[model samples]
Target: MFFVYKILIINILYYWHNDCFTCIGNINLYHMRTIKLLFTTLTLAVLATACYTEVIIEDEYIDEPVLNVHALLKSHELWYVDINATSGNREVPFLQRAFTVSFVGETVFANNNIVGIGKTGNGFGLDVGYFNTANGRLQINHDVDGYWSLEVFMVDNNTIELYDSNSRTSYYLEGYQRNNFDYDMVFYDNIEYLLQEYDVWEKVTTSKEGLLNDFDSENYLQFYIEGNRSMFNSSVDPSGMHLDDVLWDYSGEYSVFGVYNDETLKTLTLDYDFMGNDYFELYVINDSTIELYHSSSGTVYKFKGKGFISYLKSGISQLDKKRTKTEYGTMKVVRKRKI
Candidate 1:
């Protein structure tokens, strides 16, 4: 019995020493040693009892904090609508059209205009609607699109999916702060849409270095989305004329080509119907101005954008606006005098 008790006491001391070592840094080293010494002395006195008592160790479980949907929605200042990542055939009109959306208190803001994307509302754009969250559902009451209830699914730390059951559509959004967001990418990727936002492009300056051509006679230009085609209207209505008062002398289709996949540098081709096509290198001077360098005549023309349109509050949804691709072939070059 003495030898058995000696073996049991040794086992107990080993277990106590291991447990005490766990607290080496947490507890003072001297205090841990003192605790082990005291525990060992006590265990020796109650060796028989300690041998009979079975020790069952259990792991303590910690519950993860439940994520609040409202807090997550407002965590980031801006949520860029990843329209290309949309998973469903159907789409939420407002979300499909918006470049970015923000949730601030009860107001819902959207950056619908690519021209004024980074500069407008300091990157939040305009308050186009209101939103409320409850029972893990986000309810949006848009000024033009009406009401919509969506279920939010977290894709990751910075990505989310707003799933609309009625439409069976999922709109993916990536969160970002205003300062860190890539505004230039958005501006160039959707540059075609920016052209449609202006009511007219009025000629402000014409460089005299290049040879004067038929394009010099054109003073006012208008680009509009018609059905599924990108259309342009050119006028010789002179400068300083009201946008609505300008008389269009020519109307045809236009195409924008990327120069060596560079977004900043683009070539615009004007299909002048039977008058042949005119090519010009396009340059964005500012938010409201553009420079066009004529390739044929080496003339440079600067046009200022007029009448900015924000599609968010304009009551125009994405479905209402359409764009289509057109293929052009070699046509007979015919130069006609401006009538």
Candidate 2:
């Protein structure tokens, strides 16, 4: 009986020890799982904050004003004749008149001659100056009485600045257009004086735009003269007067040319009768050649420049025998004088 009781007691004690060990293992595992979950949550929060991105930007703006521009004209000589009042259906002197004139505005005639924009009560008056601005380009003003005037500015060797009677603005201009002048903007009057004064620009080659004329700063001299065909309305083919020959003087105030015509087989012919169409056309071509077109006999003609006598010889040699005059000796000299 005593042995049986001792065996039962030992068995009970062994079972209790096994249960205590099992409880300790369960508590350790739970603590380890809780620590792992907390670590994962902290890692996810950090990653979410780091994944976000940022962006930035800016803006732009500009401001400017409107302007009005015009090209003006001035002339010292004018000629007028009466064609309808001639006697015997032949041209007779009705009136030989001459006067000083200055004109402006647009020139749309086949001749490109235009009215002056600066026409005053007595003559042409042009007011050229500049206005100040808070910023940007300076304002150019042409305050003529008859018309609103604007002057276009250009850049050249000289840095253009704006100047009027009282003040020179911070801006400067190199060139502008006046009735498209013979060379358009290629030759601007305002910078002519400056270009002529600068040794660096002096003797520079000319282009379609203009050359640096060392003589007159206000003139962009073309190489050609202006004239009209004298035979366009004559008893001859009328169209036979289509010959053009006149060397122009861009530096001069006016260009005067005597009317002369010839055929290779004939002698030199001079035009005595006067008509309105008799005139000279001066203009620049390809910026290099100064071409002259004469109007006479109701026809228009073109001529090579006076500076190139060799060009004339080449041109004359290429003409047909009928238009070549051998007996007239040397062709009469044509001079382009300043007005």
Candidate 3:
């Protein structure tokens, strides 16, 4: 049936072309113009048949394995630096603040400008940031728990100072000192003693959960204690005398409690009134005790240790409050670490 149709169409074209050509010689102006139009149409049809396009469609959504790229500070280290067009010239690579990225394992992220050292699995990872760049010389010391923690500072082009957290000691290195390879590897006997003492503290606090439950109903004096010693505490006085006093209040996505005094990085406790309004107390304390050795009072107020759940809940509330304060407006733009 298809062949027969093709044959019929061909016969019609042949007759039409023949009629048009014969009429062109003896016809009037109108008839000659019609023949020309027919001839042009047939020529176009023949040309169209010879030129056809073959199209191939591909499925772009097919799943396949792919390797991802990350900003690598060192071979084993990766840090997150958010790139926005407005950062700078849009050409130079900016040393970004450090953050950890967990690709296969944990990676330390530090403010690339600061010398950083942290405890690695069995050894330590250290990087020095200088040279108009960051993490210029990435080095590691080998020893089981060899260099558990690090702090770095640049003394000069060839010299950098480092402090180890595990050892709690500092060392200086000349630019060309020991081929930059050999570490003076000092073993502090005192570190061993401190570790043993710390172990005793750990054993006593191992049953923290049971201790918290035991004080389920006890009235605290505005402190949270890990043992007889308070790890965190707050104030109860409304006159804003305590560190945990109503310095600020917030709620929403986060709740916040903050205390500021003349001292920088001073320690203080935040107390919460679990019975009254959801307000918290802020009080100053010594190392691990809610007791404040005030020059005026010269007496220690036995602060109470609230339960872990309430303390954490109050902390969360404080986070929300902080967020609100940030939204309102920031008085100072102090840089801090975040994860």
Candidate 4:
């Protein structure tokens, strides 16, 4: 029984260590958000908790204690790790404990006895571990946003050295999306047709949810240019929202590296600031619109950015193309200029 008590303490400490980190992390990094991925998972874990009821079995039957760690670091918030005992005869005996993310950095959160009481799936409770009074589900506030990477240890004996950016919260981001922008530029002088502006983000895929930029039709996208650099608004969350609505005038700036693909003349290499974060790669559509695809989330954003260039840009003779006014008092593209 004494040996069993030792194993129990080990299991509790492994998980509670994380909780202590969380408690300390919350105090130290109050400016950062407390993002929780486990809240959604608690539903199933809570159901499993009903089967458990503090048992102290013979330590002789149990094997060496093996610990498994799972940490999810997102949105520039607190680091969290789920600690569990793996190589034991009793399945639930290993139990589930969580510690703050700092464990990867320091050994301070090594202490255990952090317990969550009352409901099994509920937040921290008074019965165990370091968080004897923490309650409710782990929460991540909406306004709090940003991202960072960490060396996370997982149960499968592998380490994820990197993570996705904050922009990819909606999609299942893959590793390829984390590449840096460093390469030779491919400029096409004649492809200035892309500089014209319009609200080109029309419905593309049928998923409806696929469209990330959903600004009002009347308040379409626009671009302001000076030299090779241009400026525009960084897309806000909830899609369809405009910076004006939030009284924010945060405009993003990007350098025009010109067309990236010589053969297609459709791809543009732009280095742009998205609320301080920079990203690259844009595609031109029939000399009318631009497209940006975030590989991580697999989301494609379209921007009319500017109106179509004048006759000088189209390389038309002006005589071949005729513009006429319709009865409704709007100009129509009746015909294009030819050589």
Report the number of the highest-TM-score candidate. 1
* Superposition error at 105 for model 1 (Å): 1.5
Q: List candidate 3 stretches off by more than 4 Å.
A: 1-26, 54-258, 261-292, 298-339
The ten-residue window of minimal lDDT in model 1 covers 330-339
The clash numbers for all candidates, in the given order, read: 1, 52, 31, 23
Q: Estimate each model's TM-score.
A: 0.72, 0.21, 0.26, 0.25
Identify the candidate with maximal lDDT.
Answer: 1
What's the CA error at residue 304 for candidate 1, in Å? Answer: 0.5
lDDT of each: 0.79, 0.26, 0.28, 0.30
Model 4, 1-339: lDDT tens digits are 444544765676568767777675555443233323333254345556655679878667757543222223222122222222122222111011212211222111211111111112221111221111012111221111212221222223222222123222111111111122111111122222234223223323222333343222222334444444455443333334543343323455534433322333233233334434433245555434455544333455565433233321234311222211111111222211111
Local distance difference test, candidate 2: 0.26
Model 3 C-alpha lDDT per residue in residues 133-208, reported as the tens digit of each score: 1233323321111223334555445434444444444444332211232221111111111111110110011111
What 10-residue stretch in candidate 4 is worst by lDDT? 169-178
When 2 and 4 are scored with TM-score, the better candidate is: 4
Query: What's the true lDDT of residue 330 in model 4?
Result: 19
Q: Is candidate 1 or candidate 2 better by lDDT?
A: 1
lDDT of 1 by residue, 1-339 (tens): 556766876797689679877764676678768867876676577776656767999999999776678999998999998766787777788887788999987999988788788788878999888998977799999987899999998889999999999889888899999989987666555667777888899999998768878999999989987766789999998899988899999989998766543445666789987798888877776678888888678788999999887675555444465322222232233222111
Error of 4 at 251 (Å): 1.5
Better structure of 1 and 3 per TM-score: 1
lDDT tens string, model 2, 58-161? 56556655431221111211211111221232110101000111223321111101112123222222222233332333232322212222222323322222
What lDDT, from 0 to 1, does candidate 1 have? Answer: 0.79
Relative to the true structure, candidate 2 has a C-alpha RMSD (angstroms) of 23.6
